[model samples]
Target: MIGLGELVNSEGEFGVDDYRACLAAKHANLERAIQEEWERPAPDQISLTALKRRRLKVKDEIVRLRTGKAIGRRLAAPA
Candidate 1:
């Protein structure tokens, strides 16, 4: 699976700066989900496009969190 950076970079509609900025904002939103316990999100409350965007945001967050954990492990190892 493509990572969040790759996915955001692949967006043709946005320039690199805007894409990165948007992804950063989405990342923050996903982090908030972690704090909020995302289970109760109202599925029927949002438009289809918004729902799809949220799904992708969560997927990207998963990729980001896993990558961060791996990096942390590597950094923690004795050099």
Candidate 2:
């Protein structure tokens, strides 16, 4: 639930290169995790558990980014 106003300042401050690097890192990490998990074959229950953990990891990162951007925007805004 990040507000656009809060992220405006962050967007202005972060260069394209910085954003690209961040995206690259995130994608690499996610791909690594999925590949590691898919390598192991398991029962249905275990499969579900693994998927849930993966989903949580992704969700956590998303939340962190959203909050960070919101805070950054507020700080960047004028008084």
The lDDT of model 2 is: 0.52
Clashes of 2: 1
Instruction: For residues 1-79, write the lDDT of model 1, one tens digit per residue.
Output: 2234443333233343344455566656655654455455653434444655775875675566556543423211112
By summed lDDT, the worst window of 10 consecutive residues in model 1 runs over 70-79
lDDT measured at residue 57 in model 1 versus the true structure, 0 to 100: 71
User: TM per model?
Assistant: 0.33, 0.39
Q: Give each model's clash number.
A: 0, 1
Model 2 lDDT per residue over 1-79, tens place: 3333433444555433344345445656656666676676853667556765765675565565656653443232323
lDDT of 1 at 51: 54
Off by over 4 Å in 1: 1-12, 38-79
Top-TM-score structure, candidate number: 2
